[model samples]
Target: MQRKSWKKPALIVAVLVAVAMVTSFCRSRETAPAHGNGAPAAVPIRVAAAHRGDLDLTLKVIGRAEAYSTVNVQARVSGQLQELLFKPGGHVKQGDTIIRIDPSLLQAQLDQALGNLAKDEAQLVNAQAVLKRYSLLIGKGYVSQSDYDTYKANEGLYLASVKADKAAVELARTELSYAQIQAPFDGIAGAPLVYPGAQVTANDTSIVVLNQIHPIHITFSIPETGLAGTQASMARGTVPVTATLPGTKLPPMQAELDFINNAVDITTSTIQLKARYDNHDDHLTPGQFVEVVLPTTRLTNVVTVPVVALQNSPLGSFVFVVNADDTVQQRMVSAGPSSNGQIVIEKGLSGDERVVTDGQLLLVDGARVRIVTGNG
Candidate 1:
């Protein structure tokens, strides 16, 4: 009876111990974190705020510099270059003598023409006197009508000869004046193409190149989308433009829009335009490539955002805005022209809202977020 009673007590303690172990194992399985078989999520990138300021809408483009006036100084008359009056690469004014072709031959021709004209004039006077005598003789019946007609014909021939001689004299004078080549405008003369005593012919290589530097031109092209804005600004009044030298981060020089193409270029799909600058210092040179900036209309009190904050999806463009309660809201936005790396938000954002610029791609709508201190 004592052995039976000891076996029942030991079995009850073993049953209780097994029940406690099973209960503990069940609790641990319920409370532990679940494991995933996939890769970890990407970490959000920290970014700073871009302060809003007065933003100017500037259209940037690459362009080439051009001279407002370019002239190739060619000789109008063929002759030996007698003298180079202006120094090469020096400034010249309008009507300033540049090259002096040998005028001796032209002067001789003029003299010959003048002598011929004088001889013709003397002959014409003698013929008029003979015609007058013939008329008087015919009136008095001293000469036949046929003789008078012949005398009148001879007088007409002499008059025509005198007129022709006068024309030759004028032609000779014009040729003589052309022997002196002069500058056509105020400009800098390029290198002399012919040396002294070099024979030059009309329509051959130019004697020199002249470029007007005081007023210069900058030509550039803009995208077709910006055409309306440009036309509006131009219609309102004069619009200011600027240009800077390529490869040089220099401050832009001011210019005025002087010309705009009537139609877009079919090949480039861009609108060609030109601006005039008063380059009094002669700093701008022809053929120098540059960057052109045309200022368009300004947006007033519009929300502006950093470019990186904007995300692209199949639906449209969106941005992740962090709310006050430390959560993100996906907001769709309409964008406008971007300037200085910042974009103009046309819709879907208020100036008071805070946006996630750097870590937008990692966020989702209603995502829990922690406001990073000093990360603004």
Candidate 2:
């Protein structure tokens, strides 16, 4: 009876020990990391997203600025520069005297011409009297017809001399007027090439340069492919253009299209164009290169995302889309032109979807993602 009772107690202890071992094994299996499963925990990355909306397509190109009118002032007559009527680099109006040449020689010539004209006038008066007398003598037949003819011929010779002298007088007057140089238009003058007492010749090197700045012209070139679109836009109405000065943060100046080249450049395949701006403040200068911005028609109902969200691989461009279940989906997308650091998503994305922008390289398809809202 003692042996049987000991065996039953030992068996009960063994059964309790087996139950404790099984319980420990099940806890360990449940607590260990799961592996080789289809779904895995995802690494979190910062991201940004936005809904699609209407956007504008803009074309950008570098352009240069030019003056509306440029003039190189030159002398019209050969003479010594007697006086400077305008200060160098000063503004002048049309018909304003810019330089004066000595008129003494011209004046002397004019005086001589006048004296000769006076002598001719006296001779012409005497000729008229003689002709009148010959006419009277011929009517009375007081002398031979040949004698009267000789008097008439003498009168005609003196009259012709008077006309020649008159022409000389007019010639002298023109030379006198040429002594003064005048501005042809309203503009700012450049430095004078010839100072007072310097000799100047007609059609010689330019004495100064004058530029009209009130209405300035901006010239730029665009690829020939842009011509059709530019023409269409211009046909519809005036196209707006903005020009920004170099190395300055100031706002761009406004301008309008003035001209478009009819022919395209075969070498560069570019179309030259010009814009006019009201530069009454003289802010823009000639020959200065400027940045040009031309706004095109806006696109409607388009999808655009930050440029950083895009990834390139052998499979092409893609984006990581976050789902409602806190899972990521890798989707192939088509991209359009980028502007302002934002790229247009042409396909594979809807307005209601969220895309990863800041960080996306660590994403994998169907991976559980931790939602860290308001952390960006």
Best by TM-score: 1
All-Cα superposition RMSD per candidate: 11.1, 10.0
Off by over 4 Å in 2: 1-57, 295-376
Q: List the residue pairs that clash in candidate 2.
A: none
Model 1 scores what on Cα lDDT? 0.81
Model 2: C-alpha RMSD to truth?
Answer: 10.0
> lDDT tens digits, residues 1-376, model 1?
8768899889999999999999999997777644344323333544445345556677988887787899988887888889999888888989988889999989999999999999989988998999898887788889999988888888898899999999999999999998898888888888888798898896774788899877888989998888888887888788899888766766679999988999999998899999998988776888888888897665566678888877888988878887676677888888777876788877888666777866665677986565554644
Please give, for residues 1-376, the per-residue lDDT of candidate 2 as tens digits.
Answer: 8768799889999999999999999997777655348334456665677558876566777888787899887777777889878877778898998878889988999999999989988987987887788788788878789987887887888888889988999998888898888888888888887788888887885678888877889999988877777787788788988888879877889999879998999999998999999987777888888888775555678899888888887999988888887778888999987766778889989867787765565667876666566764
Model 2 residue 54 CA deviation (Å) reads: 9.9
Candidate 1 at 357: error in angstroms?
Answer: 15
TM-score of decoy 1: 0.68
